[model samples]
Target: MVHRIHRIHRIQTLPVTPDKAWDFFSDPCNLARITPPWMDFRIVSGCADHTYPGQIIEYRVRPFPLVRLGWLTEITQARSPVFFVDEQRRGPYAFWHHQHHFAAVENGAAVRMTDLVHWALPWYALPVRALVRRRLRIIFDYRQHALERLLGRAEQGEDACRA
Candidate 1:
């Protein structure tokens, strides 16, 4: 099999306490909520509970036309309010690993979410890579927007209390 690897790195800042931010992100269900409905991500496993090492989460995603796939992954490392790492056990990708890092910053905290994925198609390598990259960008953008909305709601609540 051929291994084609790609990495996606993102940094987002939120105006909330580390505990609060961690609480929001630590819930796996939040992922489904943030992800665009068009992607059609359904948790095949590990959604009934929060994440922990040795937990395997499987998803079935219909990302595009004629591209329905299964992504099976296991959480290898997890540190509450800090970071977590997930590696693909079986999926569309030949191999996939993702690490999510969070650190407290000026206002609240900075999140650095990185995905190191290795995947290859039986044929049409170039097209597959291009398509994956484009779809990942859209997914991350949707995540950012969802985070902003969540934070905005928190801020509005604070303002109301202060008023």
Candidate 2:
């Protein structure tokens, strides 16, 4: 069976500076705030104050009813207040690489945040793309709304979140 790579891209603008956005996102503890309640996501350990290369973060989450999962990711690359990349060391997916980028806009009055994820499922789960896609949509949509509610929304731009 051929393992297929799926991609999700999302862009959001927030009424805050790049520094402020980085301060919140760089801290691993803040992940729970943007995650959906249904996921029951929690940081098990290794949540440092800020992200850096080689940092490991551990998390537990319920991706489906009656199912719990452990997700371990390593911050492979981080450039302060600009971009960071995290790759799953162990998790539900066959592969997971997520990149987060932030830029100052409107003369530093606002921040534009972008998320790009490249992932693939195990061979056994390859046929369930529809189900997986729906789940991902829900999770990302919730994240977008949650961030907006927390940081105040700026004018939204193109959203290319396709799984």
Candidate 3:
């Protein structure tokens, strides 16, 4: 049976309006731009105009050396400029659920972005915890940096990454 395994929770505040945050993030095509190059992440199909619930996104990713995985994920939920959730339909993991949340702070001058991910590898991959923590941190760190650059970087409450 696939059991609950681990979670990756992160929060990042940016110096941008809620609208800007929503617009950039809601655009599905920008994913490849933020993802790390080594993963060889490529989107095979998805909508580019706007985001809505029940969207199916397909991709090809090389999660590890020489093993290419075809990932199919569904946008299970989306609530305008507030939050959205994506759950894996098929992939390397036994289960994967990711939630992206955004909120306006500083009276529309800044926004906070939070990502909560619950994921699990197969039972045989039990030893992955030790190695994966560091790698996932690296990936999220890169994402944070990319978001900061993309959203103009928060000069005020620049929280020291809570990944």
Task: Give Cα distance to truth, residue 126, candidate 1, Å.
Answer: 4.3
True-structure RMSD, every candidate: 6.9, 1.5, 1.6
Best by lDDT: 2
Which lDDT tens digits does candidate 3 get at residues 44-163?
998566678989989998867797889999999999899999999998789899999998999989998889998888788767766766777888888888887777788766564443
Candidate 1 per-residue lDDT, tens place, 1-163, comes to: 6555566666665677667776876677777888888888888768745678988788998888778889888889989878888888887766567787776655554333333333344444566677777777788778777877876433321111000
Error of 1 at 155 (Å): 11
Clashes of each: 0, 0, 0
TM-score of each model, in listed order? 0.80, 0.95, 0.92
Scored by CA lDDT, what does every candidate get?
0.68, 0.91, 0.84
Error of 1 at 69 (Å): 1.6
TM-score, candidate 2, is 0.95
Candidate 1: residue pairs that collide: none
Candidate 2 structure lDDT: 0.91
lDDT of 2 by residue, 4-84 (tens): 888898988889999999999999999999999889999999899999999999999998899899999999999999999
Query: What is candidate 1's CA lDDT for residue 123?
Result: 42
Error of 1 at 76 (Å): 0.4
